[model samples]
Target chain A: MTLTATSPAPAPAPAGPAPDLAALAARHGLVESGARPCLPEYTRRLWGRRHFVTAFATARLTAQYSRARLGQLWQVMTPLLNATVYYFVFGVLLRTKEGVRDFVPFLVTGVFVWTFTSSTVLAGTRALTGNLGLVRALHFPRAALPVAYAVQQLQQLLFSMAALTVILCCCGQFPRPSWLLALPALGLQATFNTGLALVMARLASRTPDIAQLMPFALRTWMYVSGVMWSVSHAVRGDKMPHLVAVALEWNPAALYIDLTRFALIDSFAAGQLPPYAWAGAAGWALLAGVGGFVFFWQAEETYGRG
Target chain B: MADAYDARTPTVIADDVHITYRVHSGRTAREVHAVKGVTFVAHKGEAIGLIGSNGSGKSTLLKAVAGLIRPARGRVYTRGQPSLLGVNAALMNDLTGERNVVLGGLAMGMTRRQVRERYQRIVDFSGIDDKGDFSTLPMRTYSSGMAARLRFSIAAARSHDVLMIDEALATGDAAFQRRSKARIAELRATAGTVFLVSHHHRTVTETCDRALWLEAGTLRMDGPAADVVAAYEAHAKAKK
Candidate 1:
């Protein structure tokens, strides 16, 4: 698009030779408009707006339930209802609960943990498209939208965790030393979800049709992630190909679900949590978290532009 | 008045900037050249007016300077972040005006403490509470004029390096127009360069010392605001 600079034709006499305007602007420390900052500076700017990210997330979460009659109760009720429905379908009808111990606690924990990742991914898909007004109106880091959506989903999950704890207590599962492990496991899962959310944010921002197709993809992923049944038992019985079994074991969602179950359920913990499980969780978090952040940051300047 | 600002300190430099928009219809794409090699230099403390006929690329040029749009060719350079005023006022309608003030302040890069400090002043400046406790109500309930006033008040709260306004001042009551005009003067006294895009030539002639006139994607005139407006008006009369 480069062309010769055709100076505007005006009658005003120059004091002397017209100095190069571009050179003058450069000498004065002016930078190109709409240019993306370097990675380090971008990170610094995003870090500086941490409070904005949290405030925005909290505001959106509050607004999400404001119009409903039950208001914030839905945060817990939605997951509880989903868990009940899954139990009826898989545990009762299909009798998938036959080999599973503490089926109620197992199903509730899986639903709550899986909800965190699914909701986060869904929110990320709309982070930019849904808030086009804010995106076009403001000049902050675009990553703030997806990260804030991830935080909002995490907040919702925390509420669901309280309900899950009550259900576990009802199922006669008392707290043990292994329960302390749930914190780090959640931290790793949150990181993984945030990273994946960032990836979805960029993808959906470009092709918003991806947002429509995401629910189907997430449903398919949930079925294979072993949310309702035992992945280990099914694999041990040789019901699937070896490669498929290995993939189901290593799948990030299943790995996270297993990590939470190992932390919260005494019966699951007694079966011996594999050493590779923790390693795989950490590996997925690092891969998705760091990779997704840089991927999103690469297109920072193009977020709101047509 | 001309000597008040240091001419050597340039705040915005649009060097042969060309902005083009791609319009897609059915199965064809058309390229519309909005701003063709428009170049100008703006200095600190100058309130420059951008006056043009409809579809003359005045708003497009301002967006390019604000870094909202990238020039397809050439470049625009600025001393600091150039804020486009009214667009930032596009806040959440479901949110209360009080919450919108906080959100808008943070969106403009203000710290939470700064927003808290300026909260009362912003509300007071908008005169939103003159009749009742309107700031507590959702912004959707507000009249268009009131909403515009609040938006202008929020943006005017912060002194920016380069501020680009697009017909935001045309709304509001006469008393409010007077208050906002004074606020613009206050912003200029702080050495901020202001770019005002308005269809009202009289407003341009009154608020700005210099003006840029664009026609058919080219810079048609650049001089004193009154002179440019007069020239543009005469051209329009001749065209009719």
Candidate 2:
């Protein structure tokens, strides 16, 4: 009987006298469903469920620090604390701030922006596997989980952005017209972070150990991306190979950090900024956002299944 | 029920569905064929009971029917989305019972306004309100029975096209089970197809019109609930 069901596809021509059960089942709306929804349809469904995504993200964020003494204030405190540590180590002790103007503000901006992407990537790794119960019991767009995690991180970043503004003001870097550019840059980075999260969500759902290994990988990425030290100053065009220097200059994270610094800081020379940084930001965002989404959607039906 | 089964549109059809699980124990990895070639057609307004002992693949088969697990060989077709009643189901442990009701209802495809409208009734139906402000407390603070009852209430709020209840009814008291059984009947009256998987023969016989008996991942019998339950009981008696 099982053989009959499995073998009906390759059987002789359909002109045979007996009506195939498989054909009958198909006619009666039976479908073998490991196939994912089409791109347009999946996007529509995901958009329709935006309320659920936002609500879930908000609920998770609210509960995230509820147990702590300061509650959501920890969102700002965490990065501020990290920025302080980096300021002491790299700014004071190691003199990473020697030639850099408004080093504290630059360090704070880097810490805040880098945390957004790194936390989003880490959270995306567990989006599906972490919510197996919800995935198994409910039938919604699974992409909602990862997208919600990204949204949660974005919300936290927005909260921390408030603290960042204050730090910049105290450091005597008043708001400039260029500071408005930080908005679009953050938007681009959010897109890139979401896409990276989607990719990591898919990967970590398949190999959960990726979640365990992401922090170290992200730390190395942080080092190379100039989160603590300026990659442009550390690796000069004359000192390093041209291709390597260009790659470092064009690194998406480095580009985003530099864009924010250009917007906020006065002494960071415009010539020091990577050329066409906005284009680079947009290009990386589109590539990762669209490619990562499609890559994740292709395996939509397999998520949360053992 | 028989007439409806004959006359109503088919809501679910399982076509030789086979579900396999990969089990890794220490060093050796092996495939466990949980559900092998079990196929059945369920029509609207039919309450079908899935009964088998431990390791019988009843839950596995139901998971396939709910689209939670993809079949290794065949497929399961449904008229609409099938909702599975899971005990823990991704509800945040730190959220209060009321908040979880909103989340669970939303997760089960209810709109925010719909969950809001049904909030009081869901809590009342689950009887969690009887604990005097317990519904306001975190879910982790509730007993397992209270949590299970709340989960059931949230799931049963909407009329599902196909509802699969797996072992959730057993977590409640007798009165709670009776109310859930009646709720299943009301769902059938609304032309919904229900698949109930339970080890309790009494619950199965009381709630289902048809029964499918599975043994070692194979369909042993599919018949009227009473006849199948009697046969299953006789087999158990013989083994004992």
Candidate 3:
């Protein structure tokens, strides 16, 4: 295979002078960037690639329903189907809806809100592992994957939220001034979901087994989160242990769900709301949002490596 | 090409770089040291061929240079963001080839307008759109070779400061290979450095000006393309 040894391997041409790499980099606007980008820079890069995030999310969402018989209808139908099943199992069979006014709407609201968190968290686990090929082949912010998944779920949730509004009206809960509050409630929930998704993506990308165990974990969380039944009613008059009851009441998921129910369900009263529901929502969002971002960013460079 | 080898024009430098990967054998975990202390300087307009046996860390070295992996020790410095040629690796098989082109372009840091303007050229380069609506079909429907060609085409659309190609040309036909060779030459002419990893001695000798021969995670030879390739072919024949 040798080319007739026509020219001896031209020895490396003499290196004229040692170049100052730092100065050279400065002159060329280059940096040693193989390491994890700093947080501020990463955020800036992420912002710069915001279009990619939305584009990716839209692509995934469209493809997700591409093969389904019901097509995009399944996005709204999946949650409504779950709401029905939960209404049967918990509301009718267990009579878990006892003492809860506008029980159907309450159950629907909880189901929709909880789905936002559970779906995002589960999808986040697969964000990196599912796109390992992309991660390996492309150079971009790894956070884009999880964030895109979260956005996809948010898109899906927006569809389900429309369904929730119809369910609310049919159940005699008309649009009230308080109904306006679901906006901030969803905003907080979305922020919280994004953070949790980031954290879960990092963990699941490393272990992978976390994906298998996530469903069971999320199921338990759903029970405690009052997805189908009121946490307040479940623990009312010391029916459950004091500490467990308090934990359920203050659970971030439960708090967000309760806030939505208070806003949308006519029977749900603001007085029954947790004293610091708004504070709790903001705190959880900040804790998960800021903390998860840092947590995920700290190991940014480690992602997609074998 | 006057100052192509000038030290001041160093386009890529790997400083005693090492890469180790954690692998599991059954239930036992172990670390495989893929690249051990490889140090080299590539100048502007250089076409470097990385030749090695299977698992000799040719791909790993390229990946480390592309910033896909942080080496266990030492560091790699590149002139700019290096685009590894398997951009199709990032393509979603479920999506149509057309969508993959757009997504792949965005991922490669091309603006929307750039991708839009070059869409026809990319499709022409890949030859997938010659038949009506073929690019609209899902990538999973395409053969592996077609997919590789498409990826190469998309990546080659943009001139990169540092480009790493891993066995991309091995899948294409003679005509495609010739076109790719010309593309690499053109890239180097534009002062872009390219690292080609391939086991095809003929391909390496023809496409690259210099060659690095790796054996079992170490650089066994580094010299002109023909010299290192001849030594490598002889070593393989002897082993056989």
Candidate 4:
């Protein structure tokens, strides 16, 4: 207990029953941990450095795949090509009648939306471990990391969707009536994916083995969500397909994808959704987002340790 | 320009800091107390060496000081930052060493352009001299020494108000060690507080004005470097 500037800072002292951190210092061995920054203080510090986060995101976006020649080009190309493969496989070969007219466009819309949801969650799962240095050395919102990934995903999604819009227009089936509904649908997807990202990332941090099974999880999700196949046949009379559709539709990711289809296929006014479904998706998003955050903050103390 | 600071204010106050890590093995979690009942104060312009043998909890204590770990039973107060050199640390493996410098600087709270402005010095400090594949070769390729040099250059590139260094500095050679020592001295001279964790008693005594000894997550001793280091060395050697 050698005296080294033991004088306390002359800041407005707290009056409320904020726990006396100093009193417990000896018992806790926190004699050196004087005034730890809380969430609000740290957030303001990080926010004041918003340009820093943006720069970090930009660097990550650019360098994440710098080794490849096509690099970011694949961000757009991969989705289009995926859409094309599904279009030919499901639309041409399966020769399924369009549940809605212009099935090629419909299939394309579904694949891209679903792709964003799956990929964002998969990549964001390692948001903490992948940037362990940044989290440990620098104090930034850990949420900012996954949010950055989402932002990066959103940027690419926005760009790719523009091209998607052009292709849809070229197909000469501009979804004017119901398309506006897709905005809320996309919002729902982003929110829900963010939530799942939190849960999975937290789980993965505790269990490294969890990351290995992500591919299998995503594949299972794809099938259940009714992305490539239509649920119309099942919805008519088959209890099995109806059961599967309801189960799949219960997933907010599927809800978002289905809404994208409705937005693109349903005419502007025709595509508008019943408030109940959107509200349902909204609830799922809230659960995933808030639940993920609490779960993450619970382990905030564990980060940066051996 | 004159410095404007509240001179009377204590920058750091850690009372009864207890950190425990649950060591996992085959589904069983054992509580390995990393730092137990540690109480210490760090003021501005102080150079403190956190010295301990392996499992002595020096690293864990340093981490707790940096606000990276949540003490299981205690509280920590830091005026602004009581964090390790790269507490939220890593050198981006895929990016070039130069890019790492920029990232490390920004992560330490320097602005983007500030990092870029000091780019040349960072590169020189890292001691990469026109090596081919410098940009293309992934950081995983660099030897541990080269990698440490790069990380240290980026981390040590900026002057921190309160900087904590783990055993990370041990990799560099004697010359680099001297340069590193000088940099830390400069930091202390300019009212910066440094907490260094090192097992090498010589390095700790040479670099820090004060030393702390931790044992199984508890503070055993804290005082002048020579006295503390001598006691720690004898105890360590005797145990061996």
Candidate 5:
């Protein structure tokens, strides 16, 4: 086992004239390391990891508030506090709630639903960057990170929903058959948010500065999504340009918020939901869900690499 | 060295792999050619040690083999997904060690039931509870060595086709080191290829049958472990 020490060690001899190593590996059923699987295969792998996704999400959510004294209570309390601030600013100070009915219920529902999208998008921006250790150490679908973050936000939204329900009941908006409509509405929003999360995860993996910029972008998006004001009421008549009104109505964030609002609030549900509301919700979910997935998958092999 | 692994069946092949990292410093980007056209083939049941001085690209080459970093010029092929266990592969620090075990096991593609079955063994292997119930405490509360032990334990609980370890064994105490070496041997007995990168030349010679020595992002020596370690040590002494 001994060899004479040399300053520049000689290269090892080729193993039988190289012998087409790639072909040999292929013949032995080897696959290229880090190669992106085809879409169906990638989907299958991601589906296989569904349990991991949920567990990872739950772990993160539980650990999020571990340092705070109030702990998990903050999950519901955070959104309730946000609604309180928004209610004061818009309902009392600016009087923007003048035209809207059941202002508290509307505001609370909008806050809960909008928080789902905003937090999911924000989490997506950090998904790959934040979990680089996991990504580099383990071999799994990269989509799992963003998908798990979306699930985390959905869980947080559920906590906020419990609070939202109590607030709705206090405001005299008791449950009705229409409350079931919120289920499909939320299901669509969750899918849409998951897709958007996938897109953001891929983007932020490369340009991590996007994470620094995302909060401002999401805040601006929140304002336009009608979290604090009703898009339909603001767009009524010539108060805004027709195209601007149409764009606001069709905005994915506003569309989800509006769908949930229409389903949960008596005032909003009493008025006929525009015929296109469900169509728009389904459209955005499919577009973002499929498009964002494909977008994220295109860069699968490149996630942890520099 | 095991009858189960036929020496002819190669488990990993690196065909002229080159990896370059563009490190961003302020507004400018600089490209560091980390692994330059490195080529090698590892067979099943073999434990290979990667030996190099600091910044010699041993870790980079290991990462390339693990599929975490793509080669810029060539390709790496493996019989199955290669898992890399590194010092930096920290699990969630804020979560309890128990939760990390579960999460790490799942991340390695273990079924929930498998994780449940192996949970106690994994904790006992880590020795995190030898003093107290440290497994229930947050990982941040454990010492760095304890965390490394736990990480290694979780990764070792499942057999992998190819496992690349980077400086993980250097942190553990002697008893843990002995246990890990035994586990690595057991892994080889199951026909898995193992790649270890360590600064301790003796650990390499004792644990691996073969060695790959990289110098300045290029492979310098590839041979029997004792020979490569001897050559590398003599080279280091000569330079001093």
Candidate 6:
């Protein structure tokens, strides 16, 4: 993949050095455009390249396990290992004395869903800076970078979800027909993730420092989101911990997973949910989704800078 | 052959654009004037080159013109859209080159179907062989030339009202340069404009019809590519 900088000997070689690319582009007025890049225009541009997005996501999923002895099995093995460890640690060791029959399913479902949200938020935040190559050389809507990241993460989650469903059903935990409702809940989770991604991708581009703290943030969020232990169970059903109580009332990942459980798990019933929880979770999704996108778009042009 | 261009409709116009960056202090923030009161015009089918020393504000001026930076004062008006090209424009190492090219194409505003349709054209132009698992490999493992090839293919594959290229072309092979130049000419002939930024004097003289020498964000020289490039080259040589 040579650049062809040495070129066919110009019929007559200019005795002096060749000018740099910058001088050449400007001298010709390519940079002379004064028009601002509109967000819709940029978005439309990204839309045109959707296949590239899907292809990239597919490649990322496949390549992640290329070097592992386990190969693509790592995809399933990763979440399995994660669920097992938490199940042992929280379900057995700390136990917090949970009484939600077959807590394993409850814990695994919540963690897997939460992992999707966290991974999307974490990856999307740094999507811009991490892909400086694509951002600078191309003129597509910059949002595609982060959206692509989220989509890639979602692909990985789909595998995890399938494995989770099989595990739960195999364990005599067949869900009610109403469990199909989980799809919309999952969609809302993704919507929230996309929004969070947009904001993070832009902010992370401006300061690489933000990316460094993401893993730690994800870990903290993991605790807050009740991936291992149910907040509803931890505070003993009657009263919830301050953060966990608030989370149960709002966190979409929690709501979405609970929606799944309400349809599947026998303990959960209609009266168990608070009135504002649905509204609050929806609000969370709206804010993160719309706010993240708008925030990122404002810095759309800046990402191209070196 | 020179591009058969229509010069009546302006491709680009930056009206006395002033751009400043703020350096904040605990006491008071100070603005760094990256560019000030700079204006220029470009017409369709013209290749313009910007030549200047490092930190001479050449890149800043180019960025301002590319719509990457908003001017503190005045405005940039384009008859059509402009695209900026850099390594950032081409591929991300974490993702495969193939994905990057498609992404690059899409970023340029082609539809998913359009990217798929042009996939072969872009891949072929990149000239990377079937070896090296181009689909599976991340660009971080690619050689500088490989990266540039993909970048070149992605950016040149599309047409634009205006295109701003940074110092990326210096890394390309001669064949690519020729191919890219022909492509640029093709784009311009179709009512597009090209803005090339480089320190390579010969490329400017050969590829551009006009040249602007940016010195500290000011437009130092704006005229025929041959004349301005010659003056700038002579000035650079004298300074050395």
Provide the TM-score of chain A alone for each candidate, in the order shown.
0.92, 0.90, 0.90, 0.78, 0.92, 0.82
Candidate 2 — which pairs collide? none
Candidate 2 vs 4: which has more DockQ = 2
Among incorrect, acceptable, medium and high, the docking class of model 3 is acceptable
| Per-prediction TM-score to the true structure, in the order listed | 0.91, 0.91, 0.91, 0.78, 0.93, 0.80
TM-score of 2: 0.91
Off by over 4 Å in 2: A1-19, A30-34, B1-8, B25-28, B170-178
- Per residue, candidate 2 scores C-alpha lDDT tens digits across B166-214 of 7655458988988987886776676478888888898889889999988
What is candidate 5's lDDT per residue for B1-240, written digit by digit as tens? 223323478889887777898787877878899887787888877899999899999887887788888888778989888877642353688899999999888888889999999999999999999999999999999998999899889888877788887764545899998898788777767648989899988889888999998889877788899999888888888889
Fraction of native contacts, model 2? 0.27
Output the lDDT of residue B67, model 2.
Answer: 80
What DockQ results do all the predictions give, each relative to the true complex? 0.40, 0.34, 0.29, 0.23, 0.46, 0.16
Give per-residue lDDT, candidate 3, residue B104. 81
Model 2, A138-173: lDDT tens digits are 778899999999999999998888888889899898
lDDT of 1 by residue, A70-182 (tens): 98898888888888898899889999899788998988898888889999999999988887767756677889889989998888888888888888998998888898888
**Model 3 agreement with the true structure over A189-285: per-residue lDDT tens digits:** 9999999999999999878889999999999999779887777767779678888877988899999999998888877888777789999999999
lDDT by residue for model 6 (B48-132), tens: 9988788778777766666666666656666555667653544456677777777666556677777788888888877765455
Q: Rank the candidates by DockQ, best first.
A: 5, 1, 2, 3, 4, 6
> Over the stretch B1-240, how does candidate 1's per-residue lDDT look in tens digits?
223323568898887777887665755767899998787888877899998899999988988898877788778889889887753434677778898898788778889999999999999999999999999998889999999899889888888789887775546999998898888778767647999999888889888999998888889878888888888887888779
Model 5, residue pairs in steric clash: none
Worst 10 residues of 1 chain B by lDDT: B1-10
Give the residue spans of candidate 5 off by over 4 A. A1-19, A270-272, B1-7, B86-90
- Is model 5 an incorrect, acceptable, medium or high docking prediction? acceptable
- Write the residue-wise lDDT of candidate 4 on A98-171 in tens digits: 56566667677778888888888887777776776666556555666666666667666786687688779888
Residue B91 displacement (Å), model 5:
2.1
